[model samples]
Target chain A: MADLIEISDPADPRLADYRDLRDVELRKSLESSEGLFLAEGEKVVRRAVAGGFEPRSFLMAPKWLDGLADTLATTDAPCYVMSEKAAEEVTGFHVHRGALASLKRRPLPSVESVLAGARSVLVLEDIVDHTNVGAIFRSGAALGFDAVLLAPRCADPLYRRSIKVAMGAVFALPWTRLPDWYEALPSLSAAGFTTVALTLADDAVDIERAVEGVDKVALVLGSEGHGISPRWQHASDRRAIIPMSAGIDSLNVAAATAVACYVTARR
Target chain B: MADLIEISDPADPRLADYRDLRDVELRKSLESSEGLFLAEGEKVVRRAVAGGFEPRSFLMAPKWLDGLADTLATTDAPCYVMSEKAAEEVTGFHVHRGALASLKRRPLPSVESVLAGARSVLVLEDIVDHTNVGAIFRSGAALGFDAVLLAPRCADPLYRRSIKVAMGAVFALPWTRLPDWYEALPSLSAAGFTTVALTLADDAVDIERAVEGVDKVALVLGSEGHGISPRWQHASDRRAIIPMSAGIDSLNVAAATAVACYVTARR
Candidate 1:
């Protein structure tokens, strides 16, 4: 069993990694600098560990210890038991999901490595919302897309809300940040993958038609605000759309991704 | 032109419908008792009006007035103009989108009325989350589904979060609560619509196969916690599954709806 320590004070030094979690910028910088990310709830934490992430430590309500004991035993990290009140105080929000773990962030895999031997992939360009990023990843993973490649400015998939919303699919999916924004699509094209960008560009064909018979496909999605950048859109081998009914302009980007991923998987 | 009245006090009775906007239970009861619902943001407000819901009143920051002036010109409802800070005070949250409107709720159409002459419909069972309910409505409308029929227990589509998340598709979609849950599926089946419930039951066929060649279809979805109840599942003509990748069990209910709607629309 993991060593169990009782923590009464929310200000303890050991809890520094979890402080002020609701401050997005602070959490981003702190997590990026500390080389760590958080996994909340028992299942996600378990998935993180199972996916080969090393845990730095764990915090949970006392009642949750037994439920997670077997998994905690596999790690050398200390598990801190605290009152739910104290846990909330440290996190700056209610910790209702029962358990949290701070796990070390591994250096991301290279785009080339993720793309290698991949049949279907999702390439995201500056999707601003963390939840959207996570949902897209979950869809890509669930629907048999082989990998995810993110643009330089896309929101981090490792953010806490993303982790929870994705139900830990982030851990299971192979994903990497594109090294160069200027040449991202071209590299995928050069790699012999058909790069299909989801857009409403007038020339865009129905997604079903666009993805048909492609040996290897990279389905590109853009941010909700501006959609695929002009440069990226221009570089794409083809443009495709979901073809919504009149009067409804667009689906939520995440919803669009799910639809596209599902169709692409079937194709 | 809407009578532009300036209200400086947050506690004014005219603003009561907009008060405590964040209190779910309070707003539920208040809106129910008063037969009113709110549409936030300028675009949603325009949709609510355009969708034929009569406006009870309009509330907006001064900056939003001109943008909505043409729409307001079509209504006799009073427009209450207030400072952004005062608007925040009355609403219990920041009114960042710059406008909100209270609209009179019409008596919902009957299940028979909604299903009449409709080819594709969605039947939701006890989906408790407002956001999920909204997203489903958005998906159904975008994919050319003619109407939606909800079990009595489904989340309110008019709820604020549903409206915002759905981008006001709730106003555009035709939906009504099923009067009798037990007979809902049977009635649709009798009305010449094939009832296909999305489930993970072992016998469920691939969704593509489940929806194939159906002229009139009623696509059923269930809640996050329990999925479709056994009664509803058994009553349906057939059960369909999304056929997810092995390691991942399922997509988010909303994402599943979009994917299913996409596939079903094509079928």
Candidate 2:
């Protein structure tokens, strides 16, 4: 069983990690410096633990403790029991999901290690939206993509919103940031993966044609605003478009990834 | 040239349709009652007009007026030019997008009309999230899905956020609310559609296999929470899932729609 601590004050030093969550800059700094990121809701908390992430601590109301009993039994980390009011005062939002846990972030696997033994992969270049990043990870993992490789500027998948939107897929997927933005596709090519970028280049073939019968594929998707950089676009072995109906410019990046991954998975 | 009105006061009654945008319930009430919805940002505003949505009025800063001159020349609607501060005061948020427009919403076409001459379609069931609805519309439009039929409770496609997320594809695509909740799939089947519910039933076929050679297909999708209603599930001609990897329950509804649309479109 986990040790239970009662905390009456929202500003208590023990509750420092949970404070000012709406302040993204402060939370980002605090989380990185302390090597901790939060997993909200009971399901996400359990998934974090089950996915092999070490919990630094947990915060919840008394009612929440029951649902997480199995999760608590497996860890020595103390579960901080506080009122819902206290949670809002600390977190700057409603604690509607009833539980939150701070977990130690593990070192990301290297690109080669994540891609090892993988037949299909997703390469996200500066997908800045946390929700989009999380949604892509969920689709990638669900469709059984082997791994995900992110550009250096891609939003952190372990960020609270990403973790929640990904429905814990971020915990299961093996992913790492590419060391060199320019050489990202070239390196994947060297490793025997065909880099098919989802773009609207004139030379682009339909997505179905691009992924057809490819043995190993890295589906490169760019950020929502500007698409893949010109260099990455040129480095790709093939350019593919989803063949949109006239008047619609493009799918949201996450939606594009889903379609691309689905086609490549079948291929 | 379009008529330009200088509105210095944020409380101008003419701008009531654009007020309290962040308040969902209030906006829904006003938009529906007035038969109007907002289109935000330059790109979305342009697409809305280009996509055939009639503008009731336009709001923009003086600098924004230059780029939209051609568009304004085509419409007789009054364009309200306001200072940035006045725009914020009226809308209850930063008007960083520079402009907003109140577009008259056309009467929703009947399901039969939306399905006219269309072989591939998407059916959304109670997808409550506006963003997901928009993303699905975008994917449907981009992937060449001919139409969309939403369950009666689905979020409004013309809702501002949905239009923004859809990049105005909602204006281009023909969609209507299914008149009957329980009979939604059965009605589609009666209309010569192969109603394929995207579900996790044990007997569900792979989406690619499910759509192969089907002349007319209606890919049915449910909401984030409770999926397809039991009635609709039972009513669909077949249940099809995207065949996710084990331990991953499902993709986000929008992502699921994207994959399903892509596969069905290729068929």
Candidate 3:
């Protein structure tokens, strides 16, 4: 069972991981370098625990400590119980969810390994927005995509805002960064995957027609401002466009990803 | 042609609608009053002009004024051309897109009128997030969903963030808030439409089956934290869920809306 430690001081050294989380520590560089990830709210924390992310420590309101007793029994991490005011002060914001867990970052598997057993995967190119990245992962996880492959310039999926928006699905989904995007495409093709680049280009086939009867597919999505890169357009085995209204160009990248995943996964 | 009116002062009363927009005019409340709606970027501004939204005025960088010569030829609104730095100071942020248009809010069409010529429509239930609201509209427009119907509590589709995130599709798609959600469902069903509610409940039918061969359908989406209300659940002609992984409960509402819209609008 985890040790329940009572913390009255906002400056306690043991609470360093959870301190200033809304400001200093919440910055992506700080959180990433410290190898710590935050799981906010009770539900996501519970999922994080279940996903094999061992909690390093927890900062919770005294009221929430008792409710988490059963889940805390499975881990040996210290649980710091504090007043809501003190917890909020220490965290640098109003902690509305009443509970938070800090877990050590697990090493990611290689891109090749994440794709090895996957039938459908998502390839994100230059998707810099954390919320969009998280939403993409959430959609990918929910829609049965086996893995998410991030190209260079994509936002860090482990960033705090990404994790919060993703509802902890970032921990559950298999994801990895590819060093060379164009190089990664041929390997996927060699592994019997069809590289389908999503674009708004005029000559591309409709997405419905492109995905028909495909067993294994990789759906490539791009940033909102720029669609897929010219390099990706050249490397793609096939190009498909989501059919849209005459005046509108395309959907948000994350929303577009969900449609692509759903359509391709349906087959 | 829009009259060129160069302004150097941030305190000018004429620029009040475009002043402190990030502060005084909350995106949600911007539509409640006679306040001007903001359209950012050249493309969105062009779309807004093309969609017949009468621009009250334009705040733009001097460089952008030259680029917008063709678009400005047909407009009668004043064009406040300023340096990029002055534009930034007036807008309280860097105007990266170099142009913005302020338009008077047009009266929304009646829900009946919006649905009159529609085949596939999206009914949003209290989706308050501007980004998600924008994203859904973008998806709806792209997927050829004929119109979008919002419940009372849903965010205004004309909100600046929604318009920007939607890449200005808020201007392209036909949308209006229904008089009441409960009353709208039955009327939709009476209008030869199949009312399909997207839910994650165990008893819900698969979305694939629910949308099969439907001529006209209303795809209902709920808010992020809460799924569709029980009232909506009860009123829906059919309940359907997107197939998802066991651990993940559902997709982000906007992403899910895209999937549902794509499924229901399949040719």
In CAPRI terms, model 1 is classed as: medium
- How far out, in Å, is residue B182 in model 2? 2.9
- Kindly list the per-residue Cα lDDT of model 1 for residues B139-240, writing each as its tens digit: 888888899988999999998889888888898878999999999899889999999999999999999999999999999999998899999999999999
Candidate 3 C-alpha error for residue B197, in Å:
1.8
- Encode model 2's per-residue lDDT on A1-267: one tens digit a residue: 678999989889998889988788898899999999999998999999999999999999999999999999999998999999988998999988999999999988888789889999999998998999999999999988988999999999999999999989888889988989988899999999999999988999988899999999999999889999898999999999887777667888898888888878888
Top TM-score: which candidate number?
A: 1
Candidate 1 per-residue lDDT over residues A1-267, each given as its tens digit: 577899999999999888998999999999999999999999999999999999999999999988888789899898989999999999998887889999999999988888888999999999989989888988888999999999999999999999988999899889999989999999999999999999989999999999988889999999998899999999999999998998786888989999999889878
Q: Report, for every candidate in turn, its global Cα lDDT versus the true structure.
A: 0.92, 0.90, 0.84
Candidate 1 chain A has its poorest 10 consecutive residues by lDDT at A246-255
Q: Give per-residue CA lDDT, model 3, range B52-141, as digits (tens).
A: 888899999788987788778888999998888877788788887888988888778998789888999999998988888998888888
Higher-lDDT candidate among 2 and 3? 2
> Looking at model 3, how many pairs of residues clash?
0
What is candidate 3's CAPRI-style docking category based on DockQ?
Answer: medium
Ranking by lDDT: 1, 2, 3
Q: Identify the runs in model 1 with alpha carbons over 4 angstroms from their true place.
A: none
How far off is residue A154 in model 1, in Å? Answer: 0.4
True lDDT of residue B147, candidate 2? 89
The parts of candidate 3 lying over 4 Å away from their true place are A1-26, A60-63, A71-98, A201-203, B6-9, B23-27, B81-92, B201-203
